[model samples]
Target chain A: MVQINAPMVGKVLSVDVKPGDQVKKNDVVLTLEAMKMQIKVYAPADGKVVEVNANAGDVVNTDTVLVTLE
Target chain B: MDQLWEIFGGIGIVHLTPGHVVMWLIAFILFYLAIKKGVEPLLLLPIGFGVFAANFPLTGLTEEGGLFYIFYHYGIETELIPPLIFLGLGAMTDFGPVIANPKTLLLGAAAQLGVYAAFFGALLMGYNVAQAACIGIIGGADGPTSIFLSANLAPEMLGAVSVAAYSYMALVPIIIPPIAKLLTTKQERAMVMTQMRMVSKTEKIIFPVLASVIIILLVPKSAPLIAMFMLGNLFMESGAVERLTNVSRNELMNIVTILLGLGVGSTMTAETFLTWKTIGVFVMGVVAFAFATASGVLIAKLMNLFTKNKVNPLIGAAGVSAVPMAARVVHNMGAEANPQNYLLMHAMGPNVAGVIGTAVAAGAFISAIL
Candidate 1:
């Protein structure tokens, strides 16, 4: 399983991915906010979502684990 | 007229030639643009004041031991001004995003095409290589970077180059959009980018060091600017240096910005500033900036052709170093292209990287000149 990582230091605005949901290589798993704007987190490769690690209102920084892909 | 000339000549400071007075008015107009138009006022206000003070007959500000004169001579002429500006800039930048997305570094480098293109363009116009490189750095929209290079390469044109860089920075909002629109279509603008991966705090904290090490090794001349910028980012991310970071960003940055602006303004003495070269430098600045923005977008468009992932060409325009302002402009334009499109975060990668890229280019220019 490959893990999706957070790309910046910011608060989690929301999670777009869910556990056990089929996802594409570039599908956004979550939105992270920083510098007064939000950025989406994309899957690194094509996979089926196996687990979600973070949720809404989470404060995240770079390399924070967001999702695990099977 | 003889008596007036004699009285002013006794000052041995300001020549008060007719050309000098015209330059003073020109300097005032620059300040007016800063204050009224809300363009890069941090530097422009003091620069304007400096010009006004320097131009008045017998002010004694720029003379040896004279206070403003001392400010100019000690700081700018001696090359202390640009580094101090870097100190403040280091305090002001946040490197979290760039560290999180290291690939964006490529975008930053891509944006520097403007600098190279303008450099050659200047050469075509009869400027020597050093002078052309100095003028080319204007596209980076980074003040200290431009000043640092110009001081080393083309000190004779320092005033014009500095003014051109700062003025174009203020004009980033105005200059980038048309070029972006002209080069890109609506579908290309509306294109959404995959979200960036989260950058860990540990990674964030280590990023400045790692980036500085890597970047400095690749471009040694960029060390001063890059090192200082990385130091500021370190202070911001270290958490242990909260007080230092706060002071650096707020008090240090604000104070230096004021002095730096004024000191730079002093360079705009009427006699040297108002000339055909001033017009040439200004035109060169716009060309440099335009080319830089266009190059970024065009590179993205070209890359999109090979990649099916669909790169948004609009993000390329953010590759210049104007920071969030240029990124925000991209966001606004992207939304205009398609209401559902949000390019802000994606735009930021290039925007922040542009800052570092321009600084590196400045470093490269200094090296070539030296």
Candidate 2:
């Protein structure tokens, strides 16, 4: 399993993938908003999401695990 | 009867002039605009109260050893508050769009034509070179930059220049649209720009340091404003100094803005603001903005003539230093032309670039004049 961490301090605006969903490399898995800017966290590699750790509207810090992929 | 007249004699009524009452009315109008019209309340509110406070008969508020005096001396005349405000603005800005499209820097540079145009206009109107340069910067549409230049080059005209700059900034929504629509066709307005690439974290982190080094090396006169601005951007992009970013963007920004506005407003004595030159300053300011908007759009059209990729000329109008407000005006105009179009992100490139470009232009004027 691989963990995906939040890259910046921001509110999680959306979770685009859930457990059992497939994502391609570079596909946006979640969106975060910081300093009124939208930041998209992309999938590092082709994978199936195994866990989702954050919800929309959750304020997150850098490196907080946001999802897990298998 | 003699006692009653004598009792009131020592009060301020005898010394008050019609000009003082008119100044009071102007202050109240500013208050009404801030509260009711929501026209840059953050700035207009403090400025309105400062004008009212300064006009209290024989208060000395605008004289030596007074509150407004200290604010103007320590904060504005010393050139401290404007740079601090730039720091906050830098922290709040996202330079990703600018990084994504480097060509938009031209739009920023193009918008500066307004400043030069206004400079010549002021000069023709018989203002000295220093005063004309200060008046011209009102075209930059950045209040702090206008104030900074005015304080340094032509301290006497600071009141008129600052008022024109801020008032035009607040009027961006109303002023930019008509000019933008008049300049572009429906096809040009609806031109859909491609999405900007995702800028990497390394690039984001390096930008401020790199920009500071380059800009300062080229125009050392702009060092104070540019240095603080880059430092704030670095703090945000580094992500290691979250507290610094928060404070820079929030508390520090708010405090500096209040002091800055009050300091500027206190300079507006009836003797300064009531002149025919003041009217000329305001008139030239509109001309500057109109020309700035036109030039941005025209430049975009010119660039499209040379490039395969077409840009929406509307984004050119966003090249003024009003930041997101100017960008939003561009976006709305694009949307009006085509509902599916999203030009906000693209317009932001020139919007932020205008901030840097304005600073550079101010530096050029400073270097040339003084």
Candidate 3:
């Protein structure tokens, strides 16, 4: 399993996928808000999402695991 | 007949001096640069004409009751036009890039080294402390800030300093690339930054207010420039104020630009602009700009040493307050180094920060000297 990390510290504005969903590289998995800007976090590779860690409205920090892809 | 000769002697044709002819030639060169070479035509065209009009002996265009006299007195001397120009600039600016990557603000601060370099150079050239401060601000590569500083500290050198600042700003494309290239390597130039995180609307709405409140509290002297700039930004970000935003960026900006140019140009009488000291200001102005660009790049490189993520050093060159022009140069240079590399969005972080940095530097100079 490959763990996808949050890029910056921010509140999760939205989550785009769930466990078992497939994502291609660069496809946005979630949106985060920090410093008054929304940041789109993208999938790092073509994979099936095996686990989802964070949900919408959750506060996250840099490198916090957001998803596990297999 | 002797009485007739004396009476006619007061006519403009009889009063024409060598200085008037020399100033006319200089004005023609400004016209050629603006119209043909296409260097900052919006301001340069009106300024060139103002110079010509002011030089035509006894036209009173620059005197108390003259046409341009109003522009000089109300627009420049009273410090009305520059802050208005800042309003337009703010409405046109997008702070998304700077807000997304806040660390780039340091690159903006780094570029102020140019202002200090020129300040000392001007002092060494025998300009007084006030005059040197005005001359040093030319390195900021921002017209309004340079004008604001000169109006307060060295009104006599306003014409020379304004011309130097605008001319160097227009030459940002030519001046920055060589220095940027010399300081960076191919691999460094090819370094692509990560994709920027998107900024939210709520964040956008908050930025202008927060910036004004914080920056003003830090430097009250910058209130005029910063306050107007934030007001314009607020007009744009509010979404409810489209009409005001459109007018500030368009009609108001155009009119103020014309008056500002004319007012600045009219100050260039032969008595003020033709002196040896004017030449020294020009020399120091270029020195300041070059140093500012170099310092930005060097600071970026220095930052790279400590940070895990490598930044393309060219963006640092955009720290000189020429806005997108300097940023575009960095983008083009990055493309030259690597075809797929696009640094425009990233370079903007430092580009806009340079504007704030220049304003802050101007405030420091104002508080210290004035």
lDDT by residue for model 1 (B1-370), tens: 9988777777745546775677678777977888898777777778787887777776777677887767766766677767666665676666655665555666777889999999999999888988899889998878888877877787678778888888887778789889999998777787767766656678877888898898899889888778877887788777888888888778877776776677677767766777777788889889999999999998888877786666688888889888778887888788677644667767777887898898888777776677
DockQ-superior candidate, 1 or 3: 1
- List runs of model 3 lying over 4 Å from the truth: A1-70
TM-score of candidate 3 on Cα atoms, chains taken together: 0.84
- Candidate 1's C-alpha runs over 4 A off are A1-70, B1-15, B307-309
RMSD of each: 6.5, 6.1, 7.9
Flag regions of model 2 displaced more than 4 Å: A1-70, B1-10
Candidate 2 residue-wise lDDT, B156-205, digit = tens? 89988987888899999999999988988998887878756778889999
Residue B156 lDDT (model 3): 96
Which 10-residue span in candidate 1 chain A carries the lowest summed lDDT? A1-10
Listed in order, the DockQ scores are 0.10, 0.06, 0.04
Scored by CA lDDT, what does every candidate get? 0.78, 0.87, 0.88
TM-score (0 to 1) of chain B, per candidate? 0.92, 0.96, 0.98
- Compute fnat per model: 0.09, 0.00, 0.00
Which digits, one per residue and each the tens of the lDDT, describe model 3 over residues B177-259? 89998999999998878867878878888999999998899988988999999899989988899999999999999999989
In candidate 2, which residue pairs get closer than 3 Å at backbone N, Cα or C atoms, i.e. clash?
A: none
Ranking by TM-score: 2, 3, 1
